[model samples]
Target: MDTGFNWVKPMLLMIALAAIPSVSLGAGLPDRIALDSLKNLYDSVQFNHAGHIRLLKDCAGCHHHTTGNLVEDANCVRCHQNSSETKVVACRGCHAAQPFSAEAQRKKQAEMKLYHQDKPGLKGAYHLNCMGCHQKMGGPTGCKDCHPMNKTGEALYNTGSFAPKKTGKAAKEH
Candidate 1:
């Protein structure tokens, strides 16, 4: 009862099993991401996502609370919402710079006040996240470092010369 196809099946199975690891590896860090969700008062911050990935070495540096095993990168809007259970609410959705009416403005302010009791609005969150990290890491503390300004006091969208370098373990694994 010797079938010639017997060897073919096992060979195919081995190949399929070998390919599983590559398939399981998630997507690589993006080259760039525009942090313009709340860009009313200033120019949109152009983040070098891949460069940050290279520098940080772990996605958990920014995307916390995942126990260091990020199946997929969580969107900021997912958890940073009015209600819990991972609802997608944009930064400006709650932290509107200029609401339509006084009532709307008041409501937004109230929501922001309640949400960010200690800090404040979206600006506070940005400052806390960016400036806090910068200060801790000894990267840059100045406001102008993160948010570049022109001579006329306008916020310049400064995409600093950050070339993406390959991250160590994560990049190699992928």
Candidate 2:
């Protein structure tokens, strides 16, 4: 029984284990997580973490490789092929909350790695990921759907008070 096929069994077992999604690992995670890394323009998102987990058993759907699931994104796999699960699974871990700030710029310049120089900031990451998935899933893609515009946002967009007032005819109709 000392044939070369002995190694094949262990290799197949490892492959099978890797194929299994990491949903079980998320059992202890909080069901609802408040995403407030970027809350200046809108209220914090009360993300139903557990609901998404149940809906999509694949942890890489949201957490990428942080949940120990191998990512299927070809671009990501190029450099992160061997990347293991990281302790921090939050988006803020990789995407800076204030990516355009002076401090963030300095940090980026200091890092020797140039591969991730164009990584989106926390806000951009949230919008891109959430909106893209929502579009395909037939979920809400409107700006106000997930993020209720706050007073600051209203003023910035010239909304609330800055909205055009009804003139003579329009006012009369109202």
Candidate 3:
């Protein structure tokens, strides 16, 4: 019962190759943060690093092979990028209906607003973690990098069937 076209090896190899270059090339930002430091901070939910990197002349500085907004290694982002659901963490879930604001917070079914007081705000955490590093590395940053006022667009993920790995799970692709 062997088709013999196993694809796991190639998939793992590509992941490894992509991970090798995600280090801090020079632009300066640490690649990790504690979970307690990540609650309610990402309102729009796209993890603004990619947008921030676009403004920099050197892409590698923030986009090293093993860090910042890509699936690589043991980075905090690698697994959590999808949040609890299979959504893009925010890209498809929230849909921006309007920009995230504290006003929306007070009306957010109570549980959501007070849910993560122990965690640092996204902006605050990013600042405390990388502000100093960027200063040392001569990097550019400002309020806009973290909280741009206007944002739009769909993430446009390819439609595909996917599932978690577990023993004895059986299904068919239509």
Clashes of each: 0, 0, 9
lDDT of 1: 0.54
**C-alpha lDDT of residue 98 in model 1:** 38
lDDT, model 1, position 156? 32
lDDT per residue, candidate 3, 1-174, as tens digits?
245657777889889767743544433342332322222332242444533544454432433322334433356456445533232332213223322477655555465655333333444444654576567767556644543332121112111122234323443431
Considering summed lDDT, which 10 consecutive residues are worst modelled in model 3?
151-160
Clashing pairs in 3: 21-64, 21-65, 22-64, 22-65, 22-66, 23-64, 23-65, 27-61, 41-122
Residue 120 shift from truth in candidate 2, angstroms:
0.8
Which of the numbered candidates is closest to the native, going by highest lDDT?
2
- How far in Å is the alpha carbon of 93 misplaced in model 1? 7.3
Q: 1-174, model 1: which lDDT tens digit per residue?
A: 469677988999889778654323334334666876445534567877667666776654654433233434345335543323223223444444433558866765777745333334556655666787888888778756655543334423322333235545668888
Worst ten in a row by lDDT for model 2: 19-28
Question: In candidate 1, which residue ranges exceed 4 Å CA deviation?
Answer: 1-29, 36-43, 64-119, 151-174
RMSD of each: 14.6, 10.3, 21.0
| lDDT by candidate, in order shown | 0.54, 0.81, 0.42
Local error of candidate 2 at residue 97 (angstroms)? 0.8
